[model samples]
Target: MVLPAVGDVDRMKRRIQSPDYRDWRKKVEDIYGCLHPVRLTGLWEIADKTSGEVLKSTSGHILAPCGNRRESVCPACSDRYAADAFHLLRAGLSGGSKGIPVEVADKPRLFVTLTAPSFGPVHNRRFTASGKQAPCRCGRYHHERDPLIGQPIDPDGYDYVRHVLWQAHSGKLWNRFTVALRRQLARAAGIPVREFADHARLSYAKVAEFQRRGVIHFHAVIRLDGPHGAVDATPSWGTTELLADAVRAAHAATHVTMKAFTIDGVPVRFTWGDQVDVRPIRAADAHQVEQADGTISDDRIASYVAKYATKGTGKSEAADRPIRSRAQIELLRTTEHHKQIMRTAWDLGAPVVCPDCHPDGPHRVDGCGCARIDHCATCDNGGYIPGPLDELNLRRWTHMLAFRGHFLSKSRAYSTTFKRLREDRQIWRFEQNLAELGVTADSVTVINHWDMTSVGHRSDEERELAAAIAERTRAARKHRYQTERTD
Candidate 1:
């Protein structure tokens, strides 16, 4: 075959050596990384048409394996995921191609907190005015360094089982509460519950948190969207106080549908307790709350939610690396304070010993004070002994039952989703690529599939190959331009 002109060869060589060429090639590969593995290989079949099917194929190494978390497991992929999430959330808060408008900031907004009901009285650190110490509920003037800060003072009396059930149903409880809220809002608006969606819409972003006792609490940024959505304006009747009132009414009136089951001929029903709190979302309020007890900041709230989204219960050693098995318990590197809790969780998960054949007597903690025992000096002996370690184990056990999900959970209309926004972004990028290549058509179709198996630096030989490709593209462009000039 006849080679291109000498000038074309020289131009190609220079383009291959250019830094811009290298950068563009890297970005093209990065886009491929954003695609799923199966789709990446299929992209090779897209016909170039003008270029006789430029079957650009690689070793299929840049694709992500699965769900990305910024945790130590996959930092590179996690960073990309976080960036995408940031843009997705911000777009809803501020108008983007997703049709969100800037006026969203002025809408009625509230930061609400709803909590699980009291399981039992715990050792709470009470502080008086001027920061003086008040006696704890345990009747001991516990110091700041006390180990029982959150431990239940009455573990046996505590409704640990109920607490666990609350967690499993918390998501459902929120749904019921929202329904009640809409009814209340409609009553205030002088409209029917069925017509409420047409007048004003409620939009919110919420995150679930596990308190020290393993009780799940919710923190949310609740916003009032206009009749239709972000594009429309809020109704004349809507106000922050009205929203707050509706929230309060919803909280007081809402109840979860409990499952009724008969255990050993005893009929039982489960339900949520009466602890609930809802507050307005204001930076000033958080500052005021912080003055008394450092309130959580926005960044703190986001980070806290993000951190727990990847974690499961502390019971499963594999679920959360922090948990330790019996064999690995000795390898704990935490302070003496945390070790006590960790050890308790491990010991509780072990199998019970055979009553007749055991040398160690029992596989349990071998405690002198049993929770089931009736009368002991520490407890009033009415089977009321409250062991702190046992309480910790109960907390862990309850968490395993309740919070068996990722942290951030919300309804369909809470906000624009990450996947939808990401797909839109990919479409925009593809369009931009078509525009740069001067492929203008009334309706262009994308045919290539992208696979992103890797995300870091390429080997030297691969870089050289990419560089050579860039040079050829550059020379081809120059040759076209020169010919057009002669014409």
Candidate 2:
């Protein structure tokens, strides 16, 4: 097969003509075509622990995974993340792997969706209960892929400040929700709230997703286990109905009062939207995701939820890196709505370098140069001052609407972690290297020393080639999986 012409075709041809091209191809496959691979030139040795004699030694360059979880940044790394998330979630739900007991399969579990409250009316495509298309308030049925569908009809009235604050504090809101859930569980079980842990444990794996409107929502698999966790038996009072009730109550009661952060001197109280969905999860052997029964299949739930782990803020709506300046926001080639949101975040996040307030350096509120009493065109407006947002390092996450939290998080008892999964993969590759080196010594110490020469491809041609390789690898995996399933 011939390669497509891309990026300085002569340069690409020169790269292909090199003697090391074959080895380079193999390494790309090994790393799954990482977009920005860290080039490490190093020496590693397997030596006898007791005798200090080297059993095997190698010195060369290696391509390491970038380890970015966002698909917009690196598809290969994102696929790896999704796969790890699947294993981690499935281990908790199915309870046969990752040291989880099989008994957890019988535990009461729920698939919960908590949404962001509406800041304003946005154009959206909706469907009725009978499956007919409903006309939007804009007096027309929008095409499914319409870019305007998620944007507000009246942008002036939209609560952008509150929305950004909610996104920034969503992590803390989740933390509060967990606490409320435990309280609700105790109330339902008729036990003391403080001792709820003694009776039952709440374990969950959650993923944050961005809605088309640019707000965040949460998809979580919440499981009710005994005090001892996955291995222990739940109390007799624990049931699917009770867990669902507790979830609903917790969702209602879980609102965070942003006392430290204010809007117009009124603290913003953030709560989940009205659309709360709770459904039970079935066993791993279920035939379909949505069975004849109301419950969903555990087999498909992991991959389904894990897919969001690789999603960006919103496709084409946000950048892959943190916004460095306001000029960068203006230069982004996306919709005006998204850019405006980013601009708002940036304005409230980063400090302005004014000659009056920050004569020495940039300051947010040190000398009160940007307050309502004085007109500062940069950040402060009428009755809107982001007091603690600057202290929160909001500028560092302006690209994500000031949301500074992990996309995927879980309780400690909720199965394996990403670190453990990556370590296991490294160990497996290490053993394979040992086998290749003809080293049979069981007792040996492995030492690795490497320094990064640089990050990313040296040229545009190399980057394009790497991207194509990653895309092809992803396509092949999908095709093979489908083929196996069909067979």
Candidate 3:
């Protein structure tokens, strides 16, 4: 994928000169300039809902956005997702939009961050209190971009198994933390855990981030409201101080355990690292991000959490898509330490085999009858497949490092949802199109039937052109947004 050089306009000359170029450009613009546009062949019609009289009918080709939220994969759709995330998060924070009450802004709100416990010491670049660069475990003051940073100081001694297992159960750990948080809040109020929900509701929107050490850290906006949720006021006792205390207490109490992995017969446990940070969110002007009194502004917190949703795992240049075979690990562009992590996740997820048939390990052999048979006097069917943390589909999630959680998630009471936001956009689009057709929404219903025709460009020339178009469109959109904000 070497891009064209100098004035290599020749690469895209054909597309730019072709008669279909205008149509192609228009289609790309309609999808907000998607990098990997899906080609669709579809039938679209607007007809009377009651009489079923078709007022408009057409059959043609169209381009749709890929809708990938990862910035590494599709910036166009990623920005779209981030914008939606910002609104959803901000609605819960500042309110006034998305059916949330404006007074919810005064609710007891805290910004919480929870991190992974250390598996082992790793090389890092740290700073002293006065801002001097501190020495790493390797006894060196590493540069910020040093390639060796975050790699295990003792590669062999580093607990790769513990790290991988923790990663796989991180989502479960977060779920447990929320439950514990509710319990802690209730205990602080001297109320039973079961009756806690009747007194107050806990709502949060959290996003997962991958630190340089290749583990997930969650940043969340926690708000306390009455039993009915955002619209209802929090009880008189639900103060920001109390909410922060409960969050810290919950972080301290939450731990998840897995089956024994060693001959010692002791269970492996996972818990959050000691770096729990809880900051109060203050109401301020949209321009204020961090207030003078050490509180974070609502606008900044929403923007901060939304960006993480587009992130990839850690500093590794690993595959964005799933890996089909173990051999692909060697081809990854990340550091050897990340490679080891991926390798551990892959191997630990392998099926257990009979000691007699494949004593060397469960590495499947060609034409082997053992893997196919159960209780065949050979392989014992692998005993439900010993996946990492018993997550049977760990192999399927190798690209994600076995963390099977949504990057951005929220409780039911947390304002609006991503689905609802997208549906609203669709409705607005429908209205715009209907107005153009001079049709009333109550009189006609639009129907769309589409099948995939193809995906992506057929040549490097088309890809380069599409990339250019995407950049231009994105810049224009940014300019428009900025202009509107100024106005």
User: Top model by lDDT, which number?
Assistant: 2
Q: How far is candidate 2 from the true structure (C-alpha RMSD, Å)?
A: 6.0
What candidate 3 gets wrong by more than 4 Å, as runs, is: 1-9, 48-58, 260-264, 312-316, 355-392, 482-487
Best by TM-score: 3
Superposition TM-score, candidate 3 onto the true structure: 0.90
Better of 1 and 2 by lDDT: 2
TM-score, prediction 2: 0.89
In order of appearance, the predictions have TM-scores of 0.58, 0.89, 0.90
For each candidate, the alpha-carbon lDDT, in order, equals 0.54, 0.83, 0.82
RMSD of 1: 15.2
Q: Report model 1's TM-score to 2 decimal places.
A: 0.58
lDDT tens per residue, model 1, 1-487: 9976764345546655877656545653443332121122334322356655433333332333334452333333444455454444444444444566767656676667787777688777788998888998878887666657656786667655455555656777777878888899999889999999989888776666656555567766677777777777889898878998998888888786443523355643433456555554333223232233333333334434344443322212222343434545456443332344344445433344332333344334555334345534543333333332342343344214334344555545545776786788767966676676566434343355565544433444344554444345446655985687521
